[model samples]
Target: MKRFLTTGCAAATAIAMTASASVAARTLDPTKAEDALEISKRVQCGVADGVPAVYHWSGKVYSRVEGEPDRHLFNGEGMNIRQCVKITDPKRGTGYRQVSREVMFYLDPETNEVLRTWENPWTGETVKVMHIANDPVNSRPNYPYSEDGKPHQISTLRRQGKWLFMPFEVPLFYHNVLAGDYQDYVGNKYHAMEIFDFAMLADEMLDTKNPTAYPTVSWVRISDWMPWMKMRGRQGQMVFNAMGAKLKSYDELPKVIKDEIALNHPEYNKPPPGDDPRPNETTWTVFKKMVDKEREAAKNNK
Candidate 1:
């Protein structure tokens, strides 16, 4: 199981001196749970209430190894279609559930074409590329109250002029499905960090006139080399940095992404149904499933 950590103190410390009460002082209340829920809804999905939205982000993936200069591994394009469902809990209060699916495709560094295979410069071996096509990356219903009956506040917030900056730092640490159970004794574990900074207009979030807030987003990721890379427990990591925004429509994605999704993954063009019930998929889990399928096929043929 992977753990996700976020501390309001850390984020507040970083921008406490800069955050000021924007014009939203008269409208949105940063302290209230209902208002905090509104802020999150606007930044993560939309304020349109029950409407689906699409987020398109693109960036380059890199290789970072000890005693070696960083190398650009591939250019990646990603898109996620999501929607928030309003849920009311008499005991827990008002909240929402975010349901969505996302996909990220790795491209050739120079040509920018979707990569099918890659030659690992470090290991000197060719390996098939497995692009990210995770589905049902949904979130639990978020309430204004914590489990202990405390108010759950969005910790990382900044208000500057007309822009509200909300930075979310998510650090992940957990068991690596591909690694041996002996990992408890050894030291192999899956670890990664993802930072998402969303910038939006305070007015759009507060004013009922605006159906949604189209916030610009910056996404940064640090993690171990993807399993598909065949790193074999190599000493290195992967870094991804990209900028994007909540687009007005899903068709607005890059042509390459649009065409790719249309051909093989047309399902990604829309958000999962509001009542979708399925387990979330991760790269490791998907990779394990693929490996298991191949093994079963080989055994059957024998």
Candidate 2:
């Protein structure tokens, strides 16, 4: 029901102007299914021993609403290494299977390194069995357009060991308020808006309480491979709930709320380990201060 990005012009400007352009150039464009599949054939999806190599990432998650100050629920710079596998012969000799493993290293925001390691203790090998490639949005056989007839792209992409599910890049940036974009296997789009034209944030970093943190607060702007007018841009706040299917607003949330959303509704929070899960206290402290400063600055500007 939600949208997805496909290889197209949407990401051109952001990727071209940034240093990571070289890597970003490889994203796939679903409009040309033949071309996308061609590229996938060229990719080395298998590891040296036939297992997929794991991919790791480091980032943060932030919270920003109208009246209340913004907060950071997660600030650890961690790694997520995933392994992709395809099994043809099962014990029952019937169905197929795919698997992925994520190893995490949560860090202390100040030092920018690992503070602790958290594994998916609940996930038995069954987690890997559920690793089917998420359905591609662009390739969806059902209703794919929004209410406004805006052309939208909705799909998932996985190549080698890398994967990008639908509507993930949104919250990732919201937590850090950074700007940028990336192309996925299908060449769908992912972008971050640089609020107030402030500094740029990296996908691997999260600027916590430091007033000087990346110096910018940005949200995501998504485009389906459809036309510009048809594309829709979502506020970061809503993206989280869409990804997780259910989430309480900052005001609605209890002072102490554990985000089991990931475990309860993985579909809503498709991107496993949605945003950085740093302590809520830090997120609260930093956001309140930023909002206070921004509110004052707004008055002076007026």
Worst 10 residues of 2 by lDDT: 238-247
- Candidate 2's C-alpha runs over 4 A off are 1-35, 38-44, 47-49, 72-74, 85-98, 113-302
Per-residue CA lDDT of model 2 for 11-88, tens digit only, reads: 665666664644444434534433333222212122222233222223454444446665442342211122222222
Clashes of each: 0, 29
Candidates in order, TM-scores: namely 0.88, 0.26
Best by TM-score: 1
In model 1, which regions exceed 4 Å deviation? 1-26
Clashing pairs in 1: none
For model 1, what is the C-alpha lDDT against the true structure?
Answer: 0.85
| Whole-model lDDT, model 2 | 0.27
Best by lDDT: 1
